[model samples]
Target: MAYVITSSCIGKKVGECAQVCPVDCIQEGEEMFFIDPDVCIDCGACEAVCPEAAIYPEEEVPEDEKRFIQLNRDFFHRD
Candidate 1:
């Protein structure tokens, strides 16, 4: 499964995740960075480097933070 970036990253787009992402699926939004689910390789590389600890596996995302899974998708699919 793809990884999701949670609210902890909303205002602190440190972007460490982006640097380590081998597939470069992370993209900076206005307030944070989002993972392009379709492109993520599930390598967990970005999650390991996130300074805010904001990244989680799709199925493992916290209950309250689960919305981020869709938000990550929305960020890439926005029209």
Candidate 2:
């Protein structure tokens, strides 16, 4: 499953995750960074380097932060 970037990263586009992402799936947003699920390799590299602890597997994201899974998708799919 793809990794999701949660609210903890909303205002912190620190980009440590992006820097370590081998597939370059992470993209900068106005307020944060979003993982392109379509491009993600599910390698977990981004999650390992996130200092904010904001990255989680899509299925493992905490209940309270699950909205981020959709948010990440929306960020890339918005028309």
Q: Candidates' TM-scores?
A: 0.96, 0.94
Off by over 4 Å in 2: none
Ten-residue stretch with the least lDDT total in model 1? 44-53
Model 2 lowest lDDT segment of ten: 6-15
Question: What TM-score does candidate 2 reach?
Answer: 0.94
User: Which lDDT tens digits does candidate 2 get at residues 1-79?
Assistant: 7999998898988999999989899999999999998989999998899989999999999999988888899988989
Winning candidate number (lDDT): 1
lDDT of 1 by residue, 19-76 (tens): 9999999999999999999999999998888889999999999999988999999999
Model 1 lDDT, full chain set? 0.94
Q: If candidate 1 were superposed on the true structure by all CA atoms, what would the RMSD be? A: 0.6
**Candidate-wise lDDT, in order:** 0.94, 0.92
Using TM-score as the measure, which candidate wins? Answer: 1
